[model samples]
Target chain A: MIKKVLIAEDHESVNISVEKTLEELGMTQTDYVYYCDDALARIQKGVQDDQSYDLLITDLSFIKDSRVQKISGGLELIPAVRQVQPDLRIIVFSVSCIPSTIEMLFGQSDIDGYVCKGRNDAKALKEAIETVAKNQRYFPRHLTQKIRQKNVHDFTEYDIKIITLLANGMRQKDIPAYLIEEGTKPAGLSSIEKRLNYIKETLEFTKNEQLIAFCKDMGII
Target chain B: MIKKVLIAEDHESVNISVEKTLEELGMTQTDYVYYCDDALARIQKGVQDDQSYDLLITDLSFIKDSRVQKISGGLELIPAVRQVQPDLRIIVFSVSCIPSTIEMLFGQSDIDGYVCKGRNDAKALKEAIETVAKNQRYFPRHLTQKIRQKNVHDFTEYDIKIITLLANGMRQKDIPAYLIEEGTKPAGLSSIEKRLNYIKETLEFTKNEQLIAFCKDMGII
Candidate 1:
């Protein structure tokens, strides 16, 4: 049973809804802050007083104001808060649905949960909180499937090199010449074409551009 | 001198900064609302009372809340507010930098100005407000240049057809075959290649995928 939770969301409406959702779970000892800096401060103060929060739910983006904030966004605040209290569970509550971003949060940041701020998000948040409370990770089912799909298709170094070149405006025919000049293996045009085709076929992408866009979106390149 | 202005921004910090900007301009009569529905209601009520606002500044995306709103976002609110108050100097204040979206707002929506919420956005907002007050349209210099570039290109029906097909996963080599079957003119592969080369040259793009992505971003296909 999670006792104390701190929410850092810039939107007042979202903050109110998150608080209400926490209350509905019969967990009333919730604190909220509108800025990332303020949230970090509260976490630090709580840790110093030996009254640390159990969970930290935060939004990624925050609109800049007149006051300068050292910890401007949630990405920076997560690590900052983690430094003070490594055991505190963190849940990212945001509207951003970028798969690559979500992947980074899960894989690199080691966040306990992610609840997208979409329709019926309050329900999602409740489930996320419950799961995190049990020391389990929670991610939206669709995103989980996407992460699984991404993991299954482990891109090779050659695949990444070609895709990066394509994304940087290198033509397919020109790619082999560039690769050959760089002394990369299998640098023939035929090899390049076959590799792109195979990668696209594996990804179920009909166009090379789609493959490129997907790579860019996934931050693979 | 603009007497009254209404700002519709969901973020409290942005709303405050906009208010401060207005105050700096010596225009004290400013009202702020966090919801599009509330902003529209204020505009409608003002119109009904014959004490209408001189200017309206709004952000396109709004964080959804528990309360159902008829005018959920600023895009819907723009036209609705325009219907009631056509003379209201409307300025889109947003972080969205998509050329297509901004182009539509300016070209189709007949908005008076647009100020992107980037670095020095407050200064931009002030300039936008001042320009709109003088019954002149305002857009960021970069956006204006992009609009000019788009105007210069003037994509033809054939151009759109080819780009649309490319965007839809059709290979350039296969495009002519599809075009010929569809009874399209100049359906030869040579002609298609020539047209593509010409478009790429005109757009200064090195790759067909770059051209395709650019077209998609500009909403040309």
Candidate 2:
């Protein structure tokens, strides 16, 4: 029963594609805006007129122009719009994979679904709309895990350092010297090796390279 | 139709939780291994006996131990097992959100599905198993978009400088001096401003602060 979607995205191609996908999904009452300000204005007007969007699909990285008067991006906009129309379903459609941003959208906002942009966005967007329409939350499987694995509580600075060095293709032996030079909490080479060893053990890997690969793959760098 | 499941995660808590989730999903024949070595061994033995795992759920960050003669991590073991038993259903349960690593797993390895560790992992894991068992490739929705949005080929050195400056909370007017100090590219304030503008547009944001927020949230710093 969800209809009358509002899309707030900066890219023209993506806007068209999302609009097309919604049409393909039999949602023809969709409105589009290329700027965050315009989208906000439309949402405000829609609310005042009592003809608001059932869902607001936005991109989190929309930049402001000289004519624009918005303080936040799509990530922040979700809450902003929710203040006026608390019942409006919000879905984020972007190409960003950073766990921190996704956590903010899911953890802090009133968002019902998050759909990524590009090739899979079209398919996923349809799935997200359908899922949210039923009052169910849908985060893409891989992203949901990535966002949940943030480990903001117990992560150490050294852990982040090792991850960064490994990402830059530094060998295991060379990592210690680099860490020592950085000097935040310099430890001996053996200690550095041991720390990595411990990390690998904790994560379930044998090679230091796998640790590097996992750190790099997880964006711990 | 999938029943028996093999879990190859190093963490005791995570492994136990995964096992519990599988049991909740009506899977009673769940096998757990703490190291990458044991996992590979189980798969090899299973292959020889022609009773391999219906689903191989593993975290790719396993450590290297000398006593264990098996391969190092999930990346290595995935292909190794695939060589022996091409149809083995392999799902990588990881905490990584790196574009390169995920791309490699999706491109180089024929992994049936991937799930992340943490709160969302338990739920996503069940969905991944169900989806992959149905013979469909399941890429997490947010990550699928991130991978597609990855324009690895488009970044220049100036882009890095701009990203670094933005990550450091530099204002647009102050960027020209920083660019001059860095001296990588010689250009006017307009050029530096233009580059930032381009980056902002590319990411789809409405303000420099949003750009900063985006980079910070994505762990690009």
Candidate 3:
């Protein structure tokens, strides 16, 4: 039932909440640590005692509170901990809802779950822990559509510039002039239309408003 | 002692949860609407009938359903509703916890509370509703430090470039040449030093590491 959990977060308030959450989930043997170095050490010691932790919950950004440690943030600490305990389940509990950042984390690490620590976090965290315990990854339902849109078409600066301009009430034909003035490559109306068409086709949208709205909703613009 | 409340959120699940939260807060007269236009209309009717709502809870983003409306998102709706019923209390409950976005909302509107609609949202919303009822502004405790840091030093694209470079392991002395290569203005070493010094002094940090860490923690870098 995915027992022993190690929580690596600096905030005492967050720690208390997470601990309470763990208790509710029936995972009683949870260890809390503020520093990543200490968290790693706890895992190592657990391994040595032949009682390794089943999961590790961490926050991406850690405050450098007078503690000089080898690992700085949760991102760095993940890779380091994986080297020592490759089988350890990881869930990122942080404030960043940036699609690219979440995409990067899932791309870079073997994170089992991610729950943003605001709003209905306890419920989300409970869902994440349960899902991860069943050996499945938990992507936020609210952001899955946006993240899926991300996978469908990667946005370049050129595409963003075009969309952003359109969002700002720029005429479609006038985009080429702005691109040319900005020294952007393929500074042609055909190129802009083609680029936008590619996105429309990928997203299966018939109208320009739909295209713009989709990008805006997904934070691509 | 705020009693009568109106909620404007598109998602049914979110509405249910928010309704429950309001119910728990002893607010019995809670009305839910899925569109911003309807929310505005309700407020207008409330005023005309002399049965005014005490508070309005809204989500920043609303899905464009089959209805054509003057007000689109909660942000636009806030101002429109304010014009109709200027004395109504407002609490923005959304998934956006972005510091600058919150700052802009506070700058643009007389919003009484802003609670992010994610993990711990019910609790945050309860706090927000209670706080706003007593005629107080409720800012998220976690993001307040970052927002205050924002008021202390506004970061421009140039400042972001320098800090991002430093965060990426670039040397302090090498920043000028990099900025020059990128064709950024005021790309001299002295300008870079002065900018860094200004930020450091404003944030009350003596060392570059402290400045960098503070920026990183605040998501400015």
- Restricted to chain B, the TM-score per model reads 0.69, 0.65, 0.67
Best-matching candidate per DockQ: 1
Per residue, candidate 2 scores C-alpha lDDT tens digits across A5-85 of 998876543565567668878899999877777787899999999898898888777544445556456755777787878
In model 2, the Cα lDDT at residue A104 comes to 58
Arranged by DockQ with the best first, the candidates are 1, 3, 2
Model 3 chain A: weakest 10-residue lDDT segment is A212-221
lDDT per model, in order?
0.80, 0.68, 0.77
Model 3 lDDT per residue over A51-139, tens place: 99999999887666456988888878898888888899999997656566577678778788888754467678889999999999999
Docking verdict class for candidate 2: incorrect
TM-score of each: 0.53, 0.39, 0.47
TM-score of 3: 0.47
- What's the true lDDT of residue B151 in model 2? 56
Between 1 and 2, whose TM-score is larger?
Answer: 1
Error of 2 at A150 (Å): 3.8
Q: For candidate 3, what is the recovered fraction of reference interface contacts?
A: 0.00
Off by over 4 Å in 2: A151-221, B1-221
